[model samples]
Target: MTHEPSGLKIIDRFSISLVRCEKRPTSPFGCKVGLRSVIIHSVLLCSSFKKSRKYSDVGKLNKINFDSLKRPDYVRTLTIRCRHLSRKESNPAAGVFRDFRNLDRLEIDRCHLKSLPSALFSGLQNLYSLVVKNAKLSVIPLDLFAYTPNMMTLDLAGNELRIEPYALRSLRNLIHLDLSNNSIDFVTNTLISLTKLKVLTMDNNRLTNIDFRRLPKTLTDLSLRNNFITTIHYVSGSVRNLRRIDLSGNRLDFIAGSGSINMLPPSLRQIDLSNNQIAFIEDKSLAELKMLAVLNLKDNQLTELKVESLSGPENRLRLLLGRNPFKCHCGIRWLIHSTEKTYPVVLDLSELNCSSLLNDNQKLSLTVADQRNLLICQYDILCPTSCICCDKPVCSCRSSCPPKCRCYRSANMESAQKTRNVVMCEKMRFDGSEEIPDTITELQINSVQLEQWDIKKLQKLRALETIRISNTSITDDQANSLYSSRVLMELQLSSTNITKVPSNIGNLSQLILIDNPLTQLTNGDISVSEIFPQSLKLEKNQL
Candidate 1:
């Protein structure tokens, strides 16, 4: 017999019998057995031998299988990211662990992962960091991070994670956890279990409330901006190690509760609460913040502001109060007056102004000096005789004629004068007559009992520069004809019975007066330069 390359051989009956006899002691057949029994036994032995040989050949082929050849070696880091994977295709990360076993860090960004697989990080026992950013993941598996005991950082930014209780129960060793740009509405106990967490960013979420007591003690930075939080409470000095807190764009009206400000660690240097509904702030709420440097309160519903609220012994604060409705009245008059001198570098005085105190009769272009004088001298007339005695000489008075020469008598006489030009008249009344004085450059008819004015015939006064008809019963058309003088520089019709002003008033090339009772003024073809002359001056009676 000869061996073939395919390991097949054809042997004669004599040769088979000789081999069977040689191994008969170990076989079940004996030498006394006939040739028929020997041949059958020999054939059975050969068949068993062939089957064993076939199994040996298959064992060699199994050593070089295609699966083992494709398996990658253990590496220090592994990253699998598929950005263009559509929803119809299978998730590429499903079988990514077939090769990566000793991976220390894995980062997956912008992938089409609908849901996380169970034990995704099981084989990565040494994984120190895992990041999944911008993935369309709606849910996180319970045991996603069970095997990664040494995970130091876990980032799941830009996902739709519904943060519930015990959502992150196994990541106890996490140092940094970022769940920003998600739709997380609540923060539960599982998030608090990250005792080793140093930094956490949960910005731009839909969180309306938060239990500050469950915050980690080691947290240094926390961001909760762009949420529907109307108030921030339930924090009882638990976050002792917090350094920075960002609560901008929340709906906070004010900071309430005892120890709420004290809960902030001394290391806290910045707090942003811009674009909120804060109307008022107590002085004591910010007195404890010694280390606070930057405070933003930009857009709020503040009608009045007191700088003393933020003043302290060692004040290191930079405040922002722009875009707030600051009423420029007695409450904020001092601030408007001293803004240039006292807070030259502190407040943004350019953006601060009176919103509601000024009447429609008042000009919007009123300067700080103008506001100061207007506020000091109210609409009430101060009579010098009220503080004078007959025995003492009237130094401020020009002359004394008779008992009827008193200020009230003179004012009453002035009120009865129907002529448009009455310098001596304390109040002038118009009855629709054309008799207007030509020397009238300044007229004061404020709060008088005047009912009618024939302004169309009063055009004869070419020298009329200012006309004050505020707090009167003049109609809109009457006011328009009164201010149509080509030489009129200032006109005041505030708090009058008029509701609108003629657009042709802008055509008065030298007109500058705009103290009207109307809510809006439409601009005409005339430019502002032509309307307001260089000699424009608004008087108290005009406003």
Candidate 2:
């Protein structure tokens, strides 16, 4: 009985049938010559396999013979670090790795593999790629990618997956599908029918909501960063070949006023929404994103901002607005006038200061001429009756005036100005019932057309200091007859048509000119310091 067709005698009869089945062989032609030399070395290694070996062979025995089957044609790739197999020791009937049909690539890092046994890779059908990183698998077998139909890439990143719902219904020719740092909350509908999926990393997981409308419509790239999103409505009408979306550290405060990334599809560019809490962003929410560029909105709470909120200047946006709370006022003066004409290099605006107007002062950059000189000093210090007389009493008005006024009291300098202290009626205007005479201190009747002062008129001015009738057409009974003057100090009237502003002017307390532009500063002709009031100052003659 002679037989020897050296492929080294078919590796010495497959190493003596694994050393006679590890010495458990009870003779009988030693188990029929080790099953006929493993069916003639698996038919000479499946006729020298490789039509890229289609998932590597699980069906080619052709009446097994060759003195007892024993095939294994030089395995391709199969790493397994941190391995912990067990389920009765990875049973293929406990023959672990019984036959690795030309395995393509199968790494199993940090494995503890909880469950997986449905012909685990049924003799490897040319598996393209399959990494199970940090596996702690909770549940995955639903025919796990049904014997690798040429899997492109499938890394189950940091797993604990409970994902089931056609758990990847046989990976439809998967492209790249990393289940990133998993603890996956939900993603059903057969994992969005992997329609030849492009790249879909489920970042950080625990997702609050994401309905990419039944995904896999050739998704471009998506990451759902640090989950638990408050509201995003997943780009509305189905991902239309989405480009890129991260959604940084979610809990989004706003973004679903009816989705509208200009109705996406234009191959969306990129979006993050950094550290979400987004205070406001309406203006057509990214107005027709004509292929959006990039937006972050770092550390939100944004006081005010508008560039159509994000898609103005015909869509070539680039904004960040670093660490918000920004209230330099007048709605951030149109982002400092559109960051000096369109995205001034993605507008960082030097870490955008102003957290609730200048506190201890200093951070103020914003220029379009400082937002039009702060809306023209908040409209000439708040309009109403622009006034500012000075002849002593720079601000907290310090009394001292003139008396007895019938008008011409010259008495040849009446004994060198006998007790009329000092008065400087700077921006003057007076008429009828003229009893302001206590030898008037400092009265600035700016813009006055004093129709007919009533409400007991300045109650016979005792020792008035500074009084400004800013842009006046006065009446609140003439500002409660100059706030019932009890040694009147400083007073101002901003932009007139006074609707309300007399609460006794906080009882003057040596009042510091209360900014008065009379409100409704500016919105259209685009000026009034862009709409000022970081705390009011206005003096260029009230612009």
> CA lDDT of each candidate?
0.54, 0.53
> C-alpha displacement of 515 in model 2, angstroms?
26
Best by lDDT: 1
Error of 2 at 200 (Å): 2.1
Lowest lDDT 10-mer window, candidate 1? Answer: 26-35
Query: How do the predictions measure up, each by TM-score?
Result: 0.55, 0.30
Candidate 1 stretches greater than 4 Å from native: 1-74, 89-102, 164-167, 256-267, 312-315, 327-356, 359-491, 494-543
Query: Candidate 2, residues 1-543: lDDT per residue as tens digits?
Result: 345432324454345321112111111111111111223333243233221222212222111222122344244554555424422221112213336566567676664555676656665677788887775776776775676787888888887775643657787888888888877777777757777888888888787777676577688888878888675444545777788888788877765324432233445777777888878777656555567777777887876666555653345577777877665555565665555555423468767766323122544555432432432111111111122433434522322232322221211122333322222232344564353444444455545566576534554555555565556666556676666666665665654455443444434543323444344334431332333323223442232
Misplaced by over 4 Å in model 2 are: 1-110, 113-122, 126-133, 136-149, 159-172, 182-196, 202-219, 224-240, 250-266, 269-272, 276-288, 291-303, 312-328, 332-543
Per-residue accuracy of model 1 over 1-543 as CA lDDT, tens digit each? 433222223255454222221111110110111111122113343333233222222212321221232222323443434434434222433334434455566776655566666755556767788888778677887777777888889888888877842546788888888888888887776767888998888888888876667788888888888888775554546677777888888888775324553233445667887898988876546555667777777788887666666543254466677777655434455444455332313356566544424333343322352333332211112234444654455433222322211111111112333212222222445453233333444455656665666565556656566665656676767767765666666665556666554555643433333444445444542343345545332223232
